[model samples]
Target: MVVKTLNGAKAVAEAVKNCQPDVVACYPITPSTHIAEEMNHYYANGDTKTFIAVESEFSAISALIGGAATGARTFTATSSQGLLLMHEALFNAAGMRLPIVMVVANRAVSAPLSIWNDEQDSMSQRDTGWIQLYCKNNQEAVDSVIQAFEIAETTLLPVMVCIDGHYLTHAVGQVNIPPQSEVQDVLPPFKPKIFLDPENPLSLGVYTNPSHYQEFREDLHNDLLQSKEKIIEIGKKFGKRFLRTYGLFEEYKLKDAEFVLVGLGSVMDNVKATVNELRNENQKVGALHLRCFRPFPSEELKKILSGKTIGVIERDLSLGAQPPLYTEIVEALQGTNTIVSSFFGGLGGRNLDRTAIKVLFQKIKSKKPLKEWIAQQKGDQK
Candidate 1:
C-alpha cells in the first residue's frame, strides 16, 4: 500500500492504472478532465498503451464499446454534458453485457450550464442498465474503482463509479493506492467468454425485432438484479484483502435511532457530522448513505427503515414528480409506517451544510410526510 496525497481524479487514475486496463477511451470534461489527463500521462510515459483521445464523448464511449467487444478490459471518464452525450452508447454497453468500467465525476446537467458538483448527471441515467456506485470520499473513490472492475467482470454488466464532481474530484486527500499485485489478485485479467472475433464471429447488439427485443431487455434486467449479489461478494472480498469493506449501502449509527436521514454521494459526510452533533444532544437521529443506486436495494432499505421517520436529502429532482431518491425510498417503504419525507438541496452545486441537515432532522421529527428544500434561505447558516 502506498500512502499518497491525491485528489479524487488522480486517485481514480492510479486505481485504473493498477487494474491494468487493456484500453482507455475518454473525452475530457470539467471535474473529470483531470482523470483523463492523468490516464493520458500514464500512456505518454509508456506505462499504458491503447489510450484513445476521441473527438467527442459519444466517440469516446463508442471506442470503448469497440474495444470491449474484442474482449479488452476497458475504461473511460466523463461528466455533465459529456455523460449525457454518451447516453446512447451507455445503453449499448449495458444491453450487450460489456464489462466496461467508467468513472462519472457527477455534475449537474445543463440548460443553465454549471460546472460544479451534483448528482444530477448520474441520477439521470438511472435506468440505463448499468451498475451505479457512489463514493463518499477520495479513498472510497479509489477503492470503489478497484472493486468496480471485479463486479462488472463477474456480472457482465457495465459499472459507473460516481464521485461528486469538484467535491471529490478536485479536493485533495490521503489515499492509499493498493499494490498492483494485490489488485491483480482481487481483479484478475478480464478474459470474457464472448467477443467480436472473425474466427468465432457472432452478433452483438444486432437488430432484435419486437419479438425478441423485450426478452433481451428482460434478461438484462434480471441479470442486473442478480448482480447485486456479486456486488456484495466482491465488496467483501476487497474488504478482506485490503482491510476496507464496502456494501450496497452504509449505515451510520442507525441501529437504535428513531429518526434517520437518507442520501448518497459526498453530502453524506455532512449528514454524518450533523448526526453526531444531534446525537450528543440526545436526538435519536441516524444516517443511511446509499452506495449502490442502480438495482435500487428496495428490500434491504425496507428492512432497515421499517419503523423510523426518514428524511431523504437529494441533489437532483425528477421535475414534475417527487425527487428521485425520495420516490424510490417511498416505494420501498410503501405499506410501512416509515413516514419518509423528501428534501431537495445542493442543486447545481449549491451548498448543503450541517445547518441544513439540522433543519431536516427537525422536519423529520414532526412525523408528518413533507417535501421541502434545504439551505435555500439566505439566512441559513453556512
Candidate 2:
C-alpha cells in the first residue's frame, strides 16, 4: 500500500491504471479533464497500451462501447454537458451489457452555462440502466474506481462511478493506493463472456421484436436490481483485501435518533459534522449517505428509517417535482409512518457549510419537512 496526496481525478486515474484496463477512451471535459490527463501521462510512460483521445463524450463512450465489445477492459471520463451528450450511448452500452467503467465528475446541467460541482448530471441518467456509485471523498473515489470495474465485469453491466466535480475532483487528499499485485489479485484481467470476434464470430446487439423486447428490458431491470448482491459481495471482498468496508448506503449515528438526514456525494461530510455537533447539544439527529443509487437500496433504507422522520438533502432536482432522491426515499418508505421531506441546496457549486446543515436539522426538529429550498443558514447577515 502506498499512501500519497492526490486530487480526485488523478487518484481515479491511478486506480484505473492499477486495475490495468485494456482500452482507455477519454475526452477532456471540465473537472473530469484531469482524469484523462493523468491517464494520458500513464500511456506516455508506457503504463497503458491503447488510449484513445476521442472527439467528444459521445465519441468517447462510443469508442468505449467498441473497445468493450471487442472484449477489452475499457474506461472513460466526463462531466455535465459531456455526460448529457453521452446519454444515448450510455443506454446502448448498458443495454448491450458491456461492462465498461466510466468516471463521471458530477456537475450541474447547463442552460445558463455554469461549470461547477453538483449531482444533476449523473442524477439525470438514473434511468439509463447503469449502476451508479457516489463517492464522498478522493480516497473513496479512487477506491470505488477499482471496485467499479470488478463489479461491472462481474454483473456484465456498465458502472458509473460518480464524484463531485470541483469539490472532489480538484481537491487533493491522502489516498492509499493499493499495490498493483494486490489490485490484480482482486480484479483479475478481464475475461469477457461475449465479444466481437471474427474467427469465432458471434452476433451481439441483435434487433429485438415486440415479443422479446419487453423481456429484454425486464431482464436488464432485474439484473441491475439483483446487482446489489454482487456489489455487497465484492465490497466485502474489497474490505478483506484492502481493509476498507463500504455499504450500499452509509449510516452515521443513526441509532436512537429521532430524525435522520439523507443525501449523496460530498455534502455528507458536512452533514456528518453537523450531526456530531447536534448530538453534543443533546439532539437526536443522524445521517444516511447513499453510496449506490441505481440499486436504490430501498429495503435497507426502510429497515433503518421505518419510524424516524427523514430529511433528504439534494444537489439536484427533477424540475418542479420533489428532488429525485427524495422521491425514491418516499417510495421506499411506502408503508412506514416515517415522514419524508426534501431540502435542495448546493446547486451550481454553491457552498453548503455546517451552519446551513445545522439549520436544516433544527428546521426538521421544529417543523415537519415540507419540500423547500435552502440557501443560507439562519441568523446570517446577507
Give the lDDT of residue 205 in candidate 2: 78
The TM-score, computed over Cα atoms with residue i paired to residue i, of candidate 2 is 0.97
Which stretches in model 1 have alpha-carbon errors above 4 Å?
Answer: 29-31, 377-382
Candidate 2 weakest lDDT stretch, 10 residues? 373-382
TM-score of candidate 1 to 2 decimals: 0.97
Worst 10 residues of 1 by lDDT: 373-382
Quote the positional error of residue 112 for candidate 1 in Å: 0.9
lDDT of each: 0.90, 0.88
The candidate scoring highest on lDDT is 1
lDDT of 2 by residue, 52-82 (tens): 9888889999999989999999999889999
- Candidate 1 lDDT by residue in tens digits, 317-380: 8888888999999999989887988899788778888887888899888899999877575654
TM-scores for candidates 1 onward, in order: 0.97, 0.97
The reply for model 2, stretches above 4 Å from the true place, is: 29-31, 377-382
